[model samples]
Target: MTAVAHTSFVIERDFLASPARVFRGWSELALKQRWTDCHSDLAGRTHTLDFRPGGSETVTMRFPQGGTCVVRFHYFDIVPDRRIVYGYAMELDGRAGSVSLVTVEFAPTPAGTRMVFTEQAALLEEGQDLAERIEGTREGFDRLARELEPAPARP
Candidate 1:
């Protein structure tokens, strides 16, 4: 027998940067690494991203205790500096963990840009960590904010 669950959530953030800058954070490999998991303890991690419509991305993370997490994403639609839609599936140590559809929308705001992230997921066995998942997703956006911060003026 297997346990399955469905959930969805939305996370929104405002960055002190332009929509183009914010969009590049996800589109560019180096920029994406600064905010994503290049800094994690995922040994032998492999990541590849193709940012155009119909393109795909794959990210693998290894856990210290046990199990490996691999996420594969396929882009369905992309509107530069506006919106992106993708569907992704996760495998945990060879076991299917979840599948999700994600949409990110960017809008010009007085402060700079407002990004809205929505994820609808179908979670599988041993994958009932919804709270942690939401927190991790939020943390990624936080890292993006830090990544986009302006450097201090040199003396």
Candidate 2:
């Protein structure tokens, strides 16, 4: 028999950059590639982003041990530098693994941008790595913090 699990998580992060900058980190394909891969062990194969309502984003990666995972996201709403809501799905070696509703919101704070990321996921039999998933997501945010830092002054 097939099994399914449900989980929802919220992660908050503070970035020392403007809300626009923080939003750009997620909205721009190139910038997003710099920090979105929480699983360093996975080799990214392709990434495409369309940052607008009715658009979609997709990424394909190869797991170190074997197999491939593809992530698909369909944009449902976008509010410039403030918020984004999307539907997410994941496939492993062409088999459906999970589906989720994801929302990310950004707000300006004295320190900089305060971002909240929320994901509600339904995990199919092949997507039972909830703990690992959360850890990877948290690590991705840590990488985002580093990516948001201003470039070093040119020599």
Candidate 3:
């Protein structure tokens, strides 16, 4: 049986803002925090993003039960207003665990930008299934969609 698998999702959002503005939200720290970090339900979690090739990002999710998980990503490619490619790994208190590849593409639309995200993950340990992981990822993207809804008009 194959231990590696790929999962893909396409998300379209109508932004009152232009594609350039939306793309900036993906690459800038302050803009990313507005949509992503502020919307996270996990308490006390912190996110650090470095937007550049060979840069890295780390998100630490702290649990009320005194446990924490850190997600780390190493940026491989970054194109302004277009795409981002990275390698990701999850760690339990700094111990490396599962690894994956992620690609995010942004295309200009009549209204805004259509974003497509794809991930290829490998289960390095026994008893982990790709289907389960992919389903979780799909749910995550859905949550992102909710978080990124367009704002009301500014008077």
lDDT (Cα atoms) of all candidates against the true structure: 0.90, 0.91, 0.69
RMSD, one per candidate, in order: 1.4, 1.9, 3.8
TM-score of 1: 0.94
The TM-score of candidate 3 is: 0.73
TM-score for each of the candidates: 0.94, 0.91, 0.73
Instruction: Name the lDDT value of residue 129 in candidate 3.
Output: 66
Pairs that collide in candidate 3 are: none
Candidate 2 yields a Cα-based lDDT of 0.91
Candidate 1 per-residue lDDT over residues 1-155, each given as its tens digit: 67679899999899999999999998999889778874466566778999899999999887777778899999999999999999999998898889999999999998899999999999986637999889998888889999999899999
- Candidate 3 deviant stretches above 4 angstroms: 1-17, 34-43, 127-132, 146-148
**CA shift of 62, model 2, Å:** 2.3
Worst 10 residues of 2 by lDDT: 36-45
- Tell me the spans in candidate 2 whose CA falls farther than 4 Å from its real position: 39-44, 152-155
Q: Which tens-of-lDDT digit does each residue in 1-155 have in candidate 2?
A: 57788899999999999999999998888889989866667755789998899999999999778899999999999999999999999998999999999999999999999999999999986538889888889999898999999898998
